[model samples]
Target: MDYLRSTFVILTVIMTILTLLPFWRNQAWWVRVWDFPRLQMATLSLLFFLTEMALMPFGGPAAQIVIVLSMACAIYHALWILPYTRLYPKQVRASRLNNLPTLKIVTANVLMTNQQSDKLLALVEQHQPDILVTLETDLWWQAQLNVLENDYQHTLKCPQDNLYGMHVYSRLPMQDPLIQCVVAEGIPSMHFRVTLDSGDEVVLHCLHPMPPSPTEDDESTNRDGELVAVGHTAARASFPTVVTGDLNDVAWSRTTRLFMKISGLLDPRRGRGMFNTFHATFPFLRWPLDHVFHSKDFTLRDLQRLPEIGSDHFPILVELALNPRVGKGQRGLEIEPGDQFEAREKMNNAGVKSRHVHTAEN
Candidate 1:
């Protein structure tokens, strides 16, 4: 019993520390990276609490304290994730304007090294999304998806072998198109206007920021900065906007919430489901890295996590109905205090030290 107590107590502290690491808002990869696994942390914390209770039902005060701390961590994470579950009120309302013009999009991250183009092609054909956005695409993926050009006349392609490459194909025509590296060099994001069947023009922004990881970036500064910069742009845009891609940040993360509020955009996932899209190969270790967020001017018609296509990510499909008259029923988020300040700091941190990069064709 003494041995078990010592082991579990130490592990419990470790879990609690890691769970609280993201609160520091530290940009270092090791610290900020913990933001991605809140769900997993909650699970582990709960398990530690329960197992300790069952195994050592009667321990000293220290043991009891450790158990309580574990439970606290679990509750902490659960509260953060609860808004995303059906139990909470939706931030973005359901669509009542089904008759209005709709746009369906499919966003996929075809691992740059993965060669299974047919699986993705088949999935795209099956859903037949009006817009298809592929990330981690290279010159090879560009050639394989040329067939989509037959149906999707308006296209934006920026194929980079560096794993940040992004490509977009749309059935609806695109205008005022521009592609630029918003933050770090070699990392690119695309922006443009899409004219829907209703003749309404909406700004579409596509991004796949470099994630904070040992193999990738050393900190979350670049990733968070890109999101901040885009959030400001979307907030200021004259027309309604839609932003989607593998943001490299989870839905529940602080950065993501800040983005939503700063941009005044709504996440269809809120009050829906996590719709975990990454690590398609590891079901237990997945989060919603791929996302689609839009202005309240639109409402959700459909959302699904499609079958994996030999990539680390599962494609996500979202169908939205656009009708300016209908969104008044939906709840919207306002920027919180310090949101602008923190966003500015993130942008400044990346801009001051990082090399500027530009890849554009307006």
Candidate 2:
């Protein structure tokens, strides 16, 4: 009984610390990684709190303190994720008038090593998105996706074996298409202007920065830096914009929120659901590493997390309408009091000195 009580107390303390770590603006991968599991942490914290309460009589004052702290952690974590749930107001307004011009996009990370082109191709054919952005694509994956070239005529390819590759294919005509590395070496993000069938032009930026994991980089600095840089670019762009890809960060992270404020873009998932996309193989462990954010000029037509396609990540499909008139109703974010200084600090810490994209080699 004593051992059990000790173990529980230790775990509660650790989880409580993890729940508060992301608030400090620390770039350590371990600490920032905690930001990905808020939902899970909330659940676990609640469970721990209940268990602590049940055992409070058997224990002592220390047990009481643990129970109270765990309860607080549970509440805080829940509040952090509440906005991403249906309970909160949607940041992007939904459009009922489907008659308006819409752009449907499907963004997927092919898991670089996962040889499942057929599954992805099937989804593409079924969804028939106006634009398709694939991340972690290698030369082999690019070749596999070549079949899409006929339908998606405007193509931009940045295939690499480095697991940071990207490719964009669009049925609509695209202008000023660019492939750029916004942070780390060999990692590429795509930037372009797509002319909708209605003849309206919208700028698009796609990213798949490396996560803070042992398999990848040491910290979230580069990831945060790339996002700030992109956010700044999106803010200054003349046309309405959309940014999408496997961002390698969760929607609830501070960096993501900062990016939203810096760019003035809205997340369609605000009131929809988590739509957790990564770790398709594990039901218990997953988060929304994939994302799509757009300017106030657009409204949500439809959004979905598509069925798994044999990769670690399930693709996300979103349909948005370019309606500037309804933008007033949408919930948007603005730069915070210290946002400029923080953005600059993040950019500097990320060590991302260049935004040049390395062209894909044959």
Candidate 3:
């Protein structure tokens, strides 16, 4: 019994230490693989508490101390994941740009297999956004969406049977709408430059990358690599950019945070609520996977999760304003340059790359 207790205690301590290592103590090779320390901390803490309850003789004072420490670690993990409580107060930024917002855009992942085209069309007509992005679109889906071409003159479409099909429609002038094969697998993504009526130039990148799931990719490394590489590209671009899609990753994950840092993009959800979109059929398991991240030049006016239209994912509509007065400093979060460099290097090292497609000059 003493040996078992000691083993449990030692393992718990090791995991707790590992959880704390990612942010500060260690950046060594082994630590990088176990980089998501918060997850380890939470899991290990739960295991320790469960072990104490299962043991024939409950742990003594030492065990009580361990429980307290474990609970603290768990709380820390929760704090990071649920950052809005700690980071955003009153659900609004103090920046001056919030005064005047810009064009409204809608992004939806209408599952290709979903049959309700009329419902989706109805929503599009009702919303009448300046820009619309649809993912998981196949050739048939493309045919169904073609009806909106009358209103939206500028368009980009990459319809496929695979999970990566994407389409973008814009009422504003779109320059250089082209399909880019970012990864080697010929997975198509659309990139273009949009000229808003205000004469502001905004670069738009619409992507639908395969996420890591048991039935999907064997690991999340590819998805992480692709996202980071795109983030690097977006960061380097001159124009203010908007990246929208079903990223297949949660908003609060370490990978997403690293992407935001490298891309210098602002998540509207930071001060707002989590606009969970996926698994529309199962509301309980849904998460904020579909995202619209923009450069600091833009201020979010409003964001809402639209009603479902037979797809497994709900649409996200956001109204943004070009806040010329809003500078990068208005971003409440601070990310280290070293971490950004490391994230970019890791992405490049993984062999995932992005390609730029130049549309014809308007």
Candidate 4:
């Protein structure tokens, strides 16, 4: 009984320590990785603390302190994610205009190894989204999705086998189309202007930054740096904008929040749900790596996590309506002098030097 109690107490302390480490703002892959599973951590901490309290009421002062500290850590982690749940008010208001120009987009990261092009095709056919963005596509996936050309008139395709390929297909016409490598080589992000039926043009930025893991890069510097670059681009835009893709980071992460603030975009998931979209095969270990964010000129119409299509990531579909009065008086994250200095430092660390390849429409 003593050994079991000691083990539980040790594990509780370890989890509490891990939860607190992310507050250091360290860019190391291991530390940033902790930002991905706040919900899971909170749940586990709650369960362990409750079990310890119920099973070992007389387990000494150290055990009691550990249990209490673990409980507090659980609440702390939960507070960071609470805004993403229905418990908090939505950051973007719902659209009430019946004739508003609405755009529906589906963003999915088809595992480069997942040969389920047919499933993705069926999903596109079913949803009939105005725009579709796919990540981790290779030459084979590009060929398989080429059939979509019949419906989508404008396209920006960068097919690479290096696990960073991206393709964007749109029914609406695109202007000033560009494909640029934001962070590391072989990874590309798309930026263009898509015109709606109402003649309004919205700037769209698509991204799929590399994730931090043992097999991949050693640090999250590149991912965080790339997001900061894109956020700055979005912030400078004079028109309505939409940014979507598999960010490879969770909504509550510090980097993600900073990106949102710097870009002046709003997340539809706020005050709605977590909409976990990754690790589709493992129900116990899922987080939202897929995202769709838009400027204040837009309001929420609908957002959903689509059914799995044999890939590790569940696709995310977001519908947004354009409203001229949307962002008035809404507070946005201001870029402080320190933030500007940090952004420059991150950009330098990222080593992004590629020029955007501009393609004239056919």
lDDT of 2 by residue, 100-164 (tens): 88899999998999997999999999989999999888899988999999999899998888888
Question: What overall lDDT, based on C-alpha atoms, would model 4 receive against the true structure?
Answer: 0.85
The local distance difference test score of each candidate is 0.86, 0.87, 0.73, 0.85
lDDT of 4 at 285: 94
* Clash tally for model 1: 0
Give the CA lDDT, 0 to 100, for residue 158 in model 4.
97
lDDT of 3 by residue, 70-113 (tens): 66766777666565333454223434454454677899999989
Candidate 1 Cα errors over 4 Å, as ranges: 352-362
- Where does model 3 exceed 4 Å of error? 1-66, 85-101, 327-329, 353-362
Decide which is better by lDDT, 2 or 4. 2
How does model 2 fare in lDDT?
0.87
lDDT of 1 by residue, 48-153 (tens): 9999998777878887899899899999988988887899888776776657888899999999999999999999889989899999999999999999888999
Candidate that beats the other on TM-score, 1 or 3, i.e. the better one: 1
